[model samples]
Target: MTEQVPVTSEMATPRRRKVFTIGAALIVLLLLLAAGTTFLWSRWTHSISNDAFVDAYLINVSPQVAGDIVEVYVREQQRVEAGQLLALIDPTPYQREVALLEAARDVATAALEKSKSELAFLEEDVPLAIAISERRLQIARDRLAEMESALLMVTRDVENGVRAASFQVEAAKAAVVLSEEDYVRYGALYEDRSATERRFEVATKSFEQARAQLEASRARLGQAEAQRQRVPITEHQRDAARGAVEEAERQVEVARLRRIEVDVKRRAVVEHRRKVTEAERAIELAATEVEYTRIVAPYDGIIARKWRHLGDYAQRGEPLFSMYDPDFVFVTCHLGEDKLDGVAPGNRVSIQLEAYGEPFEGRVLWLGSATGANFSLLPRDLSSGEFTYVIQRVPTRILVDRDERWPLLIPGLSATVRIDHGPGDPQWVEEGLRWEDRAAHLSERARD
Candidate 1:
């Protein structure tokens, strides 16, 4: 070793200053690193998902009627508008069915008309019959009253005549007796010569006249007795008239019951009307079937598949093609459960489509309440045994921005999604990376 010289104060002071500066710089670097790590960790708030796909409403088109395919106006990958005719089934059979149904309807309508006409006739006839029967009943009642009154009058007159005739007969008998007595006295006087012959002759004549009067009175009394006997016959006749009145009343009731037939006919008309309505409905159904021969697009979409061709036999409800509406295209992403705390609807999202190799603007439109595993064919059954916990993922819907200038995004396209959770700009991550690169360079320099 060589002999050492004594150190100066100036040199020692400069060395101390240099050591102090290095220590200060190290402390500053350590503080910067701690601050940078904390800032970066705080800013790492975004949720990323690569398990995403573009989705749309896939529509399955089918024929409503079964028939041979007659015309096909669209093919695979064809763009079509809503209500555009896609194909047509053979309409001959449906047309025939419609014709048959229309004929049946016509027959039903004619039958209904006939029933109505018959009902109308009965409607008039039933009341008219009832009226006639009632009038007959009234006439019978009137006749019965007349007969009764006549019977009463005849009875009274016969009784009074019999009484008068009996009195007359009694007086005539007395007169006859008196006349006979006078005749006998006159005869005696004539025989005895106590009176003249003329006087005796007059007494005889008076006696003969009284005897004749007595005979006439007897005849009138017999006639009066016969008339009194006929009074009971008149009563019997009145009773017969009363019976006639009762019969007439029954006839009126029978006529009223006869209207029930008209009611039955009305019911028949109603039944026929119901049948006609059924026939009309059948016709409507036939017409509907005829209309169903033509298949029309349900919405505006592109035909992704075609399952039938012209001249191919198709059945009802058979799927003919697959299509979808373009207006509702969106991305479906599966997000981790832990990542959902910051993701919500209306948040802006970044979508990277695998097919286009570019990013597109999107938004968080919807989020599923349950994870995809819950909806899978074999869901988790924790109750079966000991379990390994899995951080389930929630399904989220991202609506891609619709821009005609951009490429058309179809359904089922694989896409990556990055959802922005906070208002922090994503560019800041890059800025932080740049800051890290500068810090790393500075550290290397410090090491060197």
Candidate 2:
């Protein structure tokens, strides 16, 4: 019973048959591989790490003008719309400046009106003075003419007296001749004792009387000449006439000057009016600046951060709060250098976020404008000074096109990226991730 019969040869026979069957199965499997060829080919694609969080475009909110924070109308994480006021600044200083400008404008307007009145008075005075001066000058000319006429009359009378004196001299000469002849005849008679001696004496006395009348006529002529010599009554009337003429001329000149002055004053009024207008405009401008101090949302968005509150000092150009537009949010990711090869805008991309299970569809909005080497705080400039040949990563901007289901898509999320190389791929990449299926079905569970 203990002789277990050395059955090693019998065992070897079954083992050989089993080996032959195994080898034949392997040959058939190999022949099937050689006879058939199937490929699961697809389009070239790329992917990026993704998360579903609330997304919004960010902008630093600050006031154009600086002032104390008067009131804050919004809180952190608050939703806002376009033209909605978010904060307010103290407007006291701007109000005072506007008030002062308005007062200055009023003063300028009053001064302009007063200048116009003064110009009007001057215009009236000049014309009146000119008329008065003309009247006075005319009177002087008339008086001068009267004096000339009087002088001419006096000259005529003097000439008449001279002619009468000459006539009397001739008459006296004739009478004296006649008296002498008579005396001679009488004396002859007396000498002949036919006439008396007294008759001869009377004849001689008559001749003497005739000569005296001639001399008296000549003396009257001399008196008339002396009276006519004082013709122009002391050059005062002529001087007065000249003065009146000069006054008339000066008044005319004054009138002209006043006209010019009026024009200048009118121009001055216009200039002041323009200044007043400008001051009023400046007041409006300053008021607008005060309005600008109250921050307003440019579009519907959410507040990402609030750096200041009421009573907090905010400097000019300093960001007091931050906001973003949810309608324009984009996903940003960094791609390795090797992965970035041949990548361009419009390339398809998929992202896996923190909370979301699987990848999401996106289009490459743009490649980073500058390499990562140039965008860092201490950018690696490999061109100089201990150059390194390390792989460089570039940030790619992708626009997510999925429906708004969950609110976990947010900005500033970390991600990993993958790309696809399908069969028969062309060089240029395309936008959006192409999936194994076309339906944009919910894959929250399938992603895991």
Candidate 3:
């Protein structure tokens, strides 16, 4: 303008052409930017974070029991299988415990055998005692019956003797009365010279003889009654029989008590055997652990972490080495909420890494239950003061199936993901920004 130079048509055309090319380039760039907006948008976007990574399952091996580490079977990054050995623990104490349990079991078994033998002896002796008791009881009953019969007979004899004595006493009384009357009459006659003195004396002698016979019969009756009362029931034999029965019953009870004791001892033996078996099982378990000390690859994998080294002291459950299954690798992508539209579980995905420009084909396998920000160790506290809204991300698991084994991809690798939710809605990056509005804002911003 200061030179006031005249502009030729050719020159003007060239300048105009330059501006048009610039504008066209800018428009293309804008379109690209618009498409990229879906990746970071709240809906219908497929933006990937620069912090994306490839993750995989890792086995963190630990011992079930505590012990000093005796040997390690695997190195820092050795692969292992389900039953493969990883390390070994010191087994001396465990082996000793097993031996002790075995000894205890043997002792218990011997005690049980002795108990069985004692039981057998009691079984044999108890029946014999019982039989003896039964015989004695029966004999006692029979003898008691015989004694009762004899007692009755003796009682009858005494009664008869008493009756005989009573009859003699009455006869004696009659004879005395007759003799006295005759004596009195003869004495009076004699005195009157009507009877003889010798007749009086003869009547007196007859009465005295009858009285003596009555005394003798009474003495005999007394002796018989005393003898009957002196007789004992069963002649004292039943006492012995009853004593034998009681002794036999007590012996049987003692045998039963012994039998119960023997059963308890036998149970103790069984318990000991069980303990021995458990100890052996423990030894086997320890031996298995020792076998694991020679850890080997369960499958083809790489060493991810090594927490122990040669000659290092290790306790049980201490991490020694970490291994990863190279073939089981997958990328866990956290897709923004807006980008999750129509993203079904079986939707196809494309994965790209800065390291590798080529894309990998994968499928969506899972969806996370919550957002990463929600699970953060320390979340921002905005509910107390500010109206702060956060964009939440949902994790989507995508499994790469194009390759049978996972490639050189490792866990915590950066990657980008693209999801084709079937001809998605219009991209919104271009909706708000008109060229004229942008120009005005630029002029205002330039002035500031």
Candidate 4:
């Protein structure tokens, strides 16, 4: 309004170009200094590795027994708790096997009980039978002894009777001879009238009496000889009694042998018990197989993949699903061996996930004992006389801190991690600021 100078486009253009050139030069210089400072600060204070990724222990859930999948309780990406039922295999066959084994076990148990009962009866009966046989043998021995004693007495009595009978026969013969002589002399005197008739008659009667006495003595001697024959009969009876005693002794031995049979029966009982035990074990094994038909989650995790569906035939040891624990996610970084200096466990870490905008905090969990090359499938064979030196990378584990957004991160995600190796603020102080607070602070600083 007051004396405005008319500015030409060329003059204004040159002035603005000068200002822009100066500003651009100053910005370039500042960028160079910032780049240098950043490079030096990074080199001195931290180790960096781009060869990194979020990692976790991936589990391939499988069945321990083969069967048809009867039920599916989860889908892919389903979250599950520890011991939650994931699937079920057909349990009919396993249950049937268990029932069959149980029946067999019952039969075996019954047989075992029967064997035990028989053993008990024999234990009592066998000894009693043995005792009876021993008693019978003792009785037979006593009878034999009595018979022998009686035979001995009979033998002595028979010998004495025979001797006495022989003496009586000799005396009767002498008396008969003397009485005949006297009767003959008296008869001759009577016939010649030197004696009376009554005297002759008396002598004849005396001779007859002597002859009767001799006949009686011979009968007694014959009776005594008959008694000698009875001695042999008694001896035969004693021999028979001795035979009975021997037979009874044999019966006692047989009874004792029956005791051995009892031992055999006891062994049989033991065998039956063993069979029963085996059957019980078989039943338990079948029941265990039945339990295997129910597949449960081994731990709290999320199902990453599902391979078997309902009505599918699942083989033993075949994977049914894949899973991983979200809480256990960590970053595995392959750092250059030279960058490992000053890096130790519990060092602070900054992790930037490819799928997330905000960075996460972490701490060093451990350092690997071997280089990546050592675990390569096709390792270099230095024995071929050809070798190349390579800068090896060491694996380092970083345990990510838990936050509300941590569950969004998954395994196998690309990540960039910076591990702080220099002395700095305590971890608690650094972690005190939430991501929102940090972002707000950065915005404020930018405004300043």
TM-score winner among the candidates?
A: 4
Which lDDT value does model 1 have at 370?
A: 80
Candidate 2 residues 189-304, lDDT tens each?
98998887788788778867766766776676677566555545424455655666677667666755666776787787788778878988998998887787778876667788
Candidate 3 lDDT by residue in tens digits, 3-97? 77788897799889999999999999999898778545623444444445687766544444455666766665455554466666565666666
Stretches of model 1 off by over 4 angstroms after superposition: 1-45, 92-97, 311-316, 389-391, 404-407, 423-448
Query: lDDT of candidate 2 vs native?
Result: 0.67
Which one wins on lDDT? 4
TM-score of 3: 0.62
List of clashing residue pairs for candidate 1: none
Per-residue lDDT tens digits for candidate 1, residues 1-448, read 9999989997799899999999999999999999998667644767888899988667678887899999999989899987799999999999999999889889888989999999999999889999999999999999999999999899999999999999999999999999999999999999999988999999999999999999999999999998987788889989999999999999999999988989899998999999989988998998998998989887667898999999999988888888876655678998888788777676788898888866898777668888899789998788879899788888887767767634468788888898888543445345434543653453333222
Go through the candidates in order and give the clash count of each: 0, 14, 21, 0
- Writing each residue's lDDT as its tens digit, candidate 4 over 1-448 gives 6998888997799899999999999999999999999999998889988889998767788888899999999999999997899999999999999989999999999999999999999999999999999999999999999999989999999999999899899988998999899889998998898988898888888889889889999999999988999898999999999999999999999999998889999999999999999998999899888998999887778899999899999999999998876766778999899899978777899999888899999887677999999999998788989878888999987778889988878889998888899543455434433432543443333222
Relative to the unseen true structure, what is the C-alpha lDDT of residue 304 in candidate 3, on a scale of 0 to 100?
75
Poorest lDDT segment (10 consecutive residues) of candidate 4? 439-448
TM-score of each predicted structure versus truth: 0.78, 0.70, 0.62, 0.86
